[model samples]
Target: MQTAASKAPAFRAASMALPVGILTLITLMVLPIPAVMLDVFFVLNIALSVAVLMAAMNAMKPLDFSSFPSVLLFATLLRLALNVASTRVVLVSGHEGAGAAGDVIESFGQFLVGGNFAVGIFVFVILLIINMIVITKGAGRVSEVSARFTLDALPGKQMAIDSDIAAGLMTSDEAKARRAEVATEADFYGAMDGASKFVKGDAIAALLILAVNIIAGFCLGMISHGLTAAEAAESYITLAVGDALVAQVPALLLSIAAAVIVTRVTDKSDLAGHIGGQFSDPRSWMPVAVVMGALGMIPAMPQSVFLPAAAIAGYLAWHLKKRAAQPEPVAEAPPVSPDRITMEDVSDRTLITIEMGYGLVHLVDKAKGAPLVARITGVRRQLSQTFGFIVPQFRVRDSLDIDANAYRVLLGGVHIGGATIRNARVLAIDIGDVREGHAIEGEPTFDPSFGCPALWIEESERDHATAEGFLTVDPSTVIATHLDQLLSRRPDALLGPEEVRALLDTVKEDSPGLIEAIHPDPLSLSKLTRVLRALLADGISLAHPLPVLSSLALALQQTQDFEALIDRVRIDMGGWIVGKICPYGEVLPVVTLDARLESAILQGMRDPATGQPIIEPDLAGMIGERLARISADLAQRDTPANTPALVVQPPARRALNALVRARAPDCVVMALAELPTSQAVEVIAVIGAEEEQAEPQNARQEELAA
Candidate 1:
C-alpha cells in the first residue's frame, strides 16, 4: 500500500519535471540553435513570470481554488501566441539567409526592432500585462491559475505572482532576475554537507579541483588559441578528450549545486517558498548573471556547445533568484485585524515581534504518571539556559518557541497566557534592547499567566529532582483555582452531581488505571465533594471517580465496612484482568463473581438479622476475607492496603463442613430468631438448607476454599 507521506515528493517532482521537459524537448528538436536560442529562453521566462503571478494571487486574504482553469488557459494561450510569432520570425530570417549571409544578417537586424517579429513581441507583452490585471481584479483568483498548473501538472510546486512581479514579468529583465532567485534558493551546500560524510573530506577536495579546473580551462583557451577572444573561446571546445575532461568540471559543479539547492529548498521551504522569495526581487540577482557571463567570456570553449548554453544558464539562475526574492501583491486583503498593516506603506527595516509559547512536551514515567513540560517561545534563545531546559526544541517541523511575546497567547481569541520579564533572559546585549528586555531590566522580574512569583529553591548538582529536596506542594488550592476558572469559561450555568458522576464514568472507561491511581485522601475527598457540589450549583454535573473512591474508603473506615469495600474493589478489578487475559468474553463474568466470593470469605460478613458478627463459622467469610486481604497485598494503586505482604487467618473448614452436614440446629442458627420478624424472614431466604443449595453453590464453595 502506498502511504500518504511517500506519495507527496513523487507528486511534486513530476509536476516540475513535466513542464521543463515539454518546453526543453520542443526547443531542442525543431529550432536551429542560433536562430531560436532567445525563443527557447522565453519558455523559462514564462514559467518564472507565472511563479510571480502566483505569489500575488496568494496574497489574497482568503485562499480558494475556484477560477484556476480559466486563468491558466488564458495565460497559456497568450504564451503560445508569442511562441508562434517568435518562431516565425526566426524561420523567415533563416530562409532570408538562404540568399546570402549578408541578406540573413540584414533580415535579422530588421526583425530586431520592427516588422512581424516586433509586432508579435508587442502582443506578447500586452497579453502579459492584461493577465496581471485579471489576477488583481479577480481578487485571489490568480492563485488558482498556478494552483491549477500544479494540481493538474506539478503536484507539490506552488507558483505565486504579485502586481510588482507581474509588472516585471513583461519586462526583458525577467530572465536575468530568475537566475539570481535560483542561486539564493539553491542548497548544494547542505547536500555537500551530507555527501561529505560518506567520502569524509574527499568531496571537498573534488569540488576544489573542479573549481580550479574550470578557471584553468578558461586560461588555457586564452593563452594558447590564435583566434580572437570570442573565436578562441569557441575553439577551446576542440581540445582532446583530456581537455573535455576539464569541461566536465563546470557540469559537475552545476549538477551538485542544482541538487543541493533543490534538496534544501524542497526540504526547508518547499518549491513554493524557494521560488517565491528568489523570484520576488530582480536587482539583488544581477551579480550571478555577471559571474556566469564573465566565465563564458573565457576563450577556446566551443561556441556550438558553450556560448548560448552558458548564457541560458546565466539567464535561468538570475531569473530564479530574482523571482524568489520578489513576492506578488495579492489582490485581496486578509481579514481585518488591529495589527494588520499595508505592504507598500511598510519600511524595509521595520521589525515586528509576536510573543507566544509553542513547544509542548508530555512526559510519561513508568507509563502511568503523566507530567507536562512547556517552553515559553519568541524570547531570546539564550533565555532557555536560565530556565534549565534545552533550546530550539523541535518535534515534527514546528519550532516550539513562540515567535513574539507582544502578541500574547490567545486560546480562541481570549488571552489565556503571557510571558513576563522574569521568564525571559538576555542572550545578546549587542542585539539592542527588546521590549521584553526593557521590561526585564527595569522591574527585575515579571510573572507569566501560568506562573507565580519565583520561589526560593536550592539547586541540586544533578539535573533531576533528588529525594532530599523534593517539593511537596499541596495541590488542592492549585486544582481548585484552575478548575473554577475553567468552569467559568463554559457557556453552561453550572455543573451537577450526576454530571460529575458521568464525567468520572467516562474517565473510568478511557483511563481506568489513571482513575485508580488518583484515589483521593479524606481531606482531598472533602474538597472534591465541595467542588462537585459547586459544579452542581452552576448546572454542570461531574461526579468523578477519584473523589468517590476516596469518600467510600473514608466512610468504610468509620462504619466498619472495610471488608465490603475490599470485596467490591476485588470484583471490579477481576473483570478487567479476566478481559485482558481472555480473548473470548464468555468466562469473564464467572471469573468476576468468583473473585467477589473469595473477597467476601476472607473479609468476613455480618448477619444483620441476628445483629451478630460471625467469625470462622460454617460460612466462607473467614477464608474469603483472608484471600481478599491477600489480593490487596498485591495491589498497585495509590491505596494503602496494597502492601507487599499480609497475614491471612485460615478459615475453619471442618466446622463449615459440619454445619452443612449436621441435622441438629446449632446456637448460630438459633441466634437468627432474635432479629426483627422481617429481617429474620429474609435471613431464612438467604441461608437456605445448605445441602439443597450445595450443587449450585459448589463454585462459591471453591472460591471459599481459596
Candidate 2:
C-alpha cells in the first residue's frame, strides 16, 4: 500500500504553488481580467495580506521566516497588478454606473464611505500617509541598522563557535550548523532592508494611480460619452474612489506585516502569548484596575461601558495576585545507588595543553573548518623532526575563568605564555619603517608571537595595510605562530623519558648493533636524552639520528661528561650547522673577540670547581651588550653572507654560549676548533678590543679586520 513516505514526491510538487501564483499575478497585469475575476483577485489579495500578518505575529525569530523578504516583494507586485487591471476596466466603461470596475470596488465606495466620493478620497490619502511615513519608513530604518551590526558581529560569533569546539562543548557538525545560522541571519536582515522600499513605492504609486483615474475618467465621460459635468463627476468619481480604497486597504495590511517582522524580537511565544505573559504581574494590573474604577464613577462617562470594564480589570488583578502568592512545586529526584570508585577511572595529565576563552572557541571548531587544529598537527610534525623525537599531542579546552579574547599555553600543566586578540579584526604587523607620524587609523597593539608593533584594523583594511608594507594575518594564524614559538623555546622540557625511549625504539630498527653498543655500556638513555636536549636548546636540528649516534658512540669511549660530549658532537656537526646558517660553500662572515677579552674569558673558565663560568658582573654585562648590538646590526644589513657569529676560544665557548643564549638567542656562538678548515672566514667586526679605547686604534683595527 502507498504510504505518506511513498506519496512525498507528489506532495513535493504542491510546493510549486507559490511560483504558479506569482505567474498568474504577472498575467493579470497584461491581459484584461473580467469584472467577476477582478472581484475574486481583490478578495484573494486581502486574504494573502492577512495570512502574512498572522505569520509575522506567530514567528519565534526573524530567521524562522527567512523568506519573508521575498514574500513581501511578491505580495506588493500582486496588489499593484490587480490595481492596473481594475483601472483599465474602470476607464473603458466607467460612464455606465458606479459598478463599472467590479462589485467589490462599488461596494467599498458606496457602503464604506456612505456613497460620498469626497469621504472615500480622504480615507485613501490617510492610509497612504500611514503606510509610507509611519510603518514602512520605521521598518526600513530598523532593517538597515540590524544588517550593519550583524555583519560587524560575525567574527565574534565565529570565534565563539570555535571556542566551544576547542572546549569540547560542541562537536564539529554542531559548530558548522551554528555558523550557517549566523550567515543566514545576516542575509535575511540585508534583504529585508531592501524589501521595505517596495512598500513605500507601492503606497506612492497608489496615490498617483488614484489621481490619474479620477481626472482622466471625468474628462472621458463628458467629452466622448455626452454626459453633463455633474453626471460624469458623480459616476467616475465614485468608481475611482472605490478602486483606490480596494487596493489601499490590502496595501496597509502588508505594510503592517513588514513592520511587525522587522521589529519583533526573538521569543518562544506568539504575540498574544508574549503580551499576556508580560502582563501577568499583579502589581501592573492593580494600578490599571484602580484607574479604570475611578474613571467609571466620573459624571461625564458612560456608566455601562466604564463600569463593566472596571469590574473585569479588578477581577483579573485579584486572580493574578492570588496566583502569585502560591509557592511553586519542586521536582523530586531519583535515589542514588552506592558504588565503588577507583583510581583507574582517572587519566594522567597531558604533557601540553592550550586553554582559550569563549570568544576564541571557533579556532578549533571543526564545523567551521577552523585551521588551528591542522596548524597544531603541523607544528607537532615539524618540532618532532627538529628535536629528534616525537612531540606529544596537545590538549585544547575552553575556560570560563579567562577573558573572551584571551588564550594561554601550558607546558606540563604550568602556564608559559598567551595573549589577547581581536577575533573580529585582522592584525597588521608593521614590517617597514613605522615612524611616529604615520597616519593609519586603527587600534594600536603588538604582535603576540614576535612582540612587533602592529595594528588591529577592520577586515576591510587588510588590503590597504598590505599595500603600506605591513604583514596581515588572521586570528588563527596569530595563535598558531605564538604556539610554535613557545614550543621551540621549551623543547627540552617536552622531552621526557617516554619520548626518549620512543625515539630509540624507532632508531633500533635500522641500526640495532649501533644502539646496542652505545646504550647502557658507557652512555645510558637518560644521559643521551640530556645531550640531545642541549643541542635542541641551541636551535640545532637532529632530523637525522645516525650522525648524532655515531658521534656519541666515539665520544662515550673517552669521556662520559654530557658537556664534553655535546662540545665534541658540535665539532663533528659543524658542516651541517654551517649549511643551515649560510648558503652552501659561501664565505662565513663572523665577529671575533678582542685578544684581551678572549684572555680574560679564558681566565674565568679555567676554574672547574665553580661548575660554571664566573666573571665580574660589569664585564659580563658589557660582553652581552656588545654581542646583542652586533647581532641586531647584522640582521638589518642587506648582505648575502652576513649571518651573525661570535667565535671564542674552545675552553670558554660553552660558558659564553650559556651567557648570551637568553640575551641574543639568534646569534650563533662557535668555538675556533668547530670551524671547518676548508671554509673561508671573514672578520666582519671585533668586539671589546683596545680599538675603541683610542682614536688611532679604531682606524688600525678596521684596516686589520678587513
Candidate 3:
C-alpha cells in the first residue's frame, strides 16, 4: 500500500532539519566589521589550503608523522613547493589577471611586507597549531574504525557454522564445507570494499572544489551579473550568498555536507589504517582529494564561511593526535614455575624398577657397566602377599624373558607386565607385518574396555639403589630374570666424588626453590578438598586423584590460574574426569594392595617324650595372627574421619542399585571399604533396602560376609 509520495515527505524532512539549525545559529552570532576585516579572508584561504594538503596526503596513504620527524619535514617541504608552484602557474597562465609572474610575485611580496601579511601570517600560524592539536587527538579513530570494519566483514554464516560445530550441532565435514563457502563470500566483499575507498577519495576532492567555486560564483554574480542573493534564492544556489536566507545557507551547507559525508564513510571503513596493507583501496585516496580540494578553495571562500571550514579541519587534526596518545590493552596470563618435575619427567628405568619390586638385589657394579641381580624367595612371597598379581613373581633362580620388540617384560613367558607396551612412551620403535592377530598395530584403536597399564615414577636420587635391589631370579621366586653382569661389578664406579658433590649441590639449591613454588600451602586445604570432590564427581579415581589434586592445590596455593590448574588436572588424570560419575560413589580405584599375610607354620615332629631342643617348633600360626592384627591396626589408623558414610543422594546413588541389579542380580558388596563387620552389615542393608527389598538373597549375603 506504500506509494513513492509517502517516502517523499520523510526524505524532505531529513534534508531541511540540518539547514534550519545552521541558519538559526548564524543569525544569533554577531561580529564587528573591523574584527572580520583583519585579513580574515586571507587567513581562511591559507587554513583551507593547509587542510587540503593534509587530507590529500592522509588519504593517499595513512601518515605516521608523529613518531618520525623525517616524514613531517618531507610533507612540509612538499606543501611549500606546491604553494609556490600554484602561484607561479596562475600568474603565467594569466589566471591571476597579471601579465607576468613577476607581477604576481611582487603582489605576494607586497602582501608579506604590508600589514595584511602580518595578520595572515598570524592566522596561518594559529591554523597550524590548531591542526597539530587535532592531528594528535584523533589518531585512534582510524584503529577504532578498522576494528569495527574487521568485525563487520567477518562472514556471519561462517561464525554460525563454527558455533554449530562447537556445540555438536553439525557434522565436521558439513561445517568445513560451509566454512569454505563463507570464505568465498568474504573475499568478494573485500574486493568491493577496496574499490569504495578510491571512489570516496575522489568524491571528497570534487566536493571541496565545488564548495569554493559555489561561494566565489555567488559573490561574483551578486556584484557583476545583476543577480543579487535576494533574487537568486529560489533555485539551488550554486554561487556565494549575501542576504537571502537560501542563497548563503545552501552553498555553505553543501560544502560542509560534502566534507562530513567523506569523513563518515572513510571513518567507517578505517581506510587510513588499511592504506599500510592495501594502498589501492579507494578510501585511502578520498582523504587526499579532500585535502587537495580544501587547499584549492583557500583563496575562494568569504571570510565568514572560510574561517569555520578552517576551524573544523583543525578540530579533526586534534582528534587524530589524542587517539595517537592512547595505549593498547594487554592480556596477562598466569605465571608458570620452572621448578617442578611432572609425571612426564619420570625415567623409564625408574618405572620398571618400581613395578617389578625392589628388595632382592645382591650387588651392583659400574666398573664395566654390569648390574648384578639376586632374588630372595622370602621377599617375593612378601610382595605377593602385599600386592596381588595373577602372574608368578620374578625368581633369583630363573631368567626373565624380555620382549624388547614389544617393550614388555614377561614372567612365566605369558604374563606381560610394564608401562612401555600400553603407553605411548616407546618413542623409538618398529612394527612388523603379520596376517594374524599378533600383527603390530600402527595406531592403537580406542577401546573403552582397555585401561592404561602404565606406571608413573617419581623423580628421585634413589632409582639406582632401588633398581639394584629388585632384579631377582629364584626358579620358584620368579618366572625369569636378566642380570646385567657389567653393572653388578661395582656400583661406586658410576660417578667420582667431584661429580657426586656437584649433583648434590645442584639438588640442594633447586629443592628449596622448587618446594616453595610447587608445594601447596596447608591453608588452601578446604579449596583443594572442594576441587577434589568435583574431580571425583567427574569420574576421577581415588588412587590417581591425589597426584592431580596435589598439582591443583599447589597451583592454587601459589596464586596461579584456577583454569590452568583445572586443565593440568585434566591432563594428568586423563580426559575421563571431564565426564560424569555413576551412583554409589563407585568410580573404580586405579590400583589396590592386598595387605594380608599367610601363615607358614611347620608340621608336627615325632613324639619321643624328649622335650628340650628335639624339634623346631611351629610358630607360623602365631606369626600369621600377629601379622593380621598389625595390618588391621594400621588400616584403622589410616581410616578417614568420615568413612562408612552413606551416599544417599537420590538419582546418583539409586543408579548404583539399578546397575548392581543388572550386573550382579544375586551378588552384594557394601560400598564402603574397611568397615567393621556390624557397620558393613548395616551398609548392606541400606544398599539392598533389606527392610523393603528383603535381605540380599543368597550370593549377595555371602559377598557381604566375605
Candidate 4:
C-alpha cells in the first residue's frame, strides 16, 4: 500500500508531461528570453533531436519505436518555437553585434563561418535545401508508401493468424496478441506518414524565419542606430544566418531520424546487430573481395586504396567461412521435471475431441455452458454408462481451418467425420416420415450422421416442418447427434490401457477373486485390455462387466489360447446373448444359408494368417442384399427390437462377420454351437434357397441389441 501511494503522484506527473511540454513550447514562442536562457533552450533542442535520432537508429523494427512519430511532432514544435524566440532576439538587438541572440548563435556566425556573413548566409541556405529537398522528402514518401501497404495487407495478416488457430497450431490468446501487433504496426506507419510532414514544414519555417530576421535586422540596424551599410549588413546578416543555422541543424537531425525509423525491418536484435549478422555470411564477403581485387588490378584504378581494401575483405571472408564451418556445440537437454505441464498440461486430454468452425462457435454459450456442449456432455455420459467405463472427458475447441459453419470430430488427432450446418437453423431430416411433395422450403443438405436427406431451415419453420411429419432438430442436436453416431460405431476405439486399468480397478472393489481368474494369472493388463476391447468390438458393454467377466472366467477353464478363449467366452454367454433378442420367452428369428451355399463359403479362400476362410465379394454382396430386405420387413412388424440373427457353422462365423458388418450392421451373425438349448429358432429366410444368401454382422443378436 505504501509503495503504491509513493508511485501515484510520480505516475500522474509522467502522464501530464505531454500537455505541460506543449504549454512550455507555446510560452517560448510568445515571450522574450535573456541570451543565457536562449543558449540553454537551444542546447536542449539539439539534445532532444540527437536522442530521437539515436532511438530511431537503434530500433530493430519500426513498431519497436512506435512513439517516434509523436516524439517527432513535439521535437518539430520545439525547433519552431526556438526559431520564433531566436528571430525576435536577433532583430531587436542587431546593433549589439554577433552575440546579440546567444553564444550558440554567435559561435555559428563568427566561428563556423570565420566572421564572414556572406559565407554564413550561403551555408544556412545549403543546410535548408538538404533538410527539405532530400532527407525530409524521401522520408515522407517512404512513410506514405509503407502506410498504404500496411493497411492493404492488414486483412490478410489477420486471416493468416486465424488460419493457424483453426489448424490447432496456435491458441486464441496468441491469435489475439498477433492481431494487436499487426494493428499497432499499421497505426505506427500511418502516424509516421503525417509526422513526416512536420519535419518538412519545420525546414520551410526555418528558412522563412531567417529571411525575416535578415531583412528586418538590416533595416533596423541602420535606421535606428545610425550605422553604415557595411556595418549593418555585417552585424544584421551574420546574426540572422546564425539563428537560422541553429534551428536547421536539429531539423536535419530529426529528418534523418524519421528516415531511419521508417526503413527498419523486424529482426531479433537492434539495427546494428541485424545488419552485422546478415553481412557475416561468408558467401557475401568472398564476392566483394574478388570484385575489389579485380578493380585494383586496373592501371587507372587507385591500387593504393583498392589493393589494401581487397586484402582486408578477403581476410574477413576467410574468417567468416572458418567460423561458419566450425560445428555448433550441442547443448545438453534439461532433465524432465515434475509439476509443470507433464501430460496434463495438454489442453485436450480427451481421446475424443470436437473442433468447431468460427460460425458454429455461437452454439456453445460460454455463460450457459453452450447448447452443443450440454448435448455432448449428455452423449458422453450415456456412452460411458453404456460401455460400463468412464469415457475420457471430451474437448470442444474453435477451429478456423474448417468451414465457418462446419465442425469435425477427431479421435486421437485424426479427423473421423465433419459437415457444415446453418449456424442457428434447425435441421429438418427426412426420416421417410414426411408426405410426398411437401411445401416445406429450406436449404437442402444431407444428415452428417445417417447420410439421410435433410434441410436447413429457420427456427420459425421448425414447428411447421415437425407438423408436416419431418424430424426437426436444432443445430446443436445435429452436431451432437452426428458425433454420437460416429463414436458409437467404434466404442472399442475409445478404450485404452488407462480405461482398462480403471475398469479393472473398479471390478477389484467388488470381485477381486473373479478378476484374478482371468487377469495376471492368465492375462496381463495389456492382454486383458485386448480381450475387453474385443468384447466391446463384439458390441458387449462393460456396463455390466460381471456377466462378461464371469463368462470370461469360465472360458479360461477350457483354453488359454486368445482366439479359443474368445470363442469359449461367446458360447458360455449364449443364454445372455439370446435373451437380448428373444427376451427369454419370445421366439427368436433366425436366418441361415442353404447347405451347398454354406459349404461353399465355409470352404472359400482361406486367410493365410488366421486360417479363417475369406468370403468372396460377389457372394458376400448377394447375401447382404437379401438380409437387408428381411431386416426391413421385420422393422415394420412391431418387433424392431428383435432384429433377426443368422446362425452359421462355428468354423464359418468368424469369416462371415466382416461382410455382415459392412452390409447389414443391424443383423447378428452367431455360430450354431453358441445358441442355447432353451432358445427357439424360427428360420426367417434360407438365404440361398431362392437367390443369394445372408449378410455378415456378428455371432449372436446380443451384440447388436447391446
The CA lDDT of each predicted structure is 0.34, 0.84, 0.34, 0.85
Residue-by-residue lDDT tens digits, candidate 4, 184-229: 9999999999999998888878877888887888789889998888
Residue 706, model 1: Cα distance from true site in angstroms: 37
Residue lDDT tens for model 2, 1-706: 9999989988887888878987898899999988999999999999999999999888888888899999998889998999899889988889999887889999998999999999999988888889899988999999999989999999999999999999899999999899999999999999999999999999999999999999998999999998898988888888999999999988899888888888888888977788789999878877777888798899899878888888888888899989989998787875644574546446437888899999989989999897789888888888887777888889998989789999999888789999998988999998765555656678999998888999999999898777777899999889888999988877778887788788788989999988887876766768777877887776566678888788877777778887788888888888777777677777677777777777877766454774766766787788788878877788787866656777777777877777777677777888877777776666767777666444434543343344
For model 4 the TM-score comes to: 0.51
Measured by lDDT, the strongest candidate is 4
TM-score of each: 0.19, 0.48, 0.21, 0.51
Between candidates 2 and 3, name the one with more favorable TM-score.
Answer: 2
Per-residue C-alpha lDDT of model 1 across residues 408-518, encoded as one tens digit per residue: 333333444333221222211112122332212122222222233322222321122222222212112222233223323331222223334445556678777554543
- Give the 10-residue window scoring lowest on summed lDDT in candidate 4: 692-701
In candidate 3, what are the lDDT values of residues 565-684, reduced to their tens digit?
543554444323212221233421110111111001012333355221112223323322333343334335533321222222121222332333233222221222222333222222
Give me the runs in candidate 3 sitting further than 4 Å from their true place. 1-40, 48-271, 279-706
List RMSD in Å for every model shown: 25.8, 24.1, 26.4, 26.2
Descending-TM-score candidate ranking? 4, 2, 3, 1
TM-score of 1: 0.19
Error of 3 at 318 (Å): 38
Q: How accurate is candidate 2 locally (lDDT)?
A: 0.84
Which residue segments of model 4 deviate by more than 4 Å? 1-4, 157-172, 290-304, 329-341, 344-706
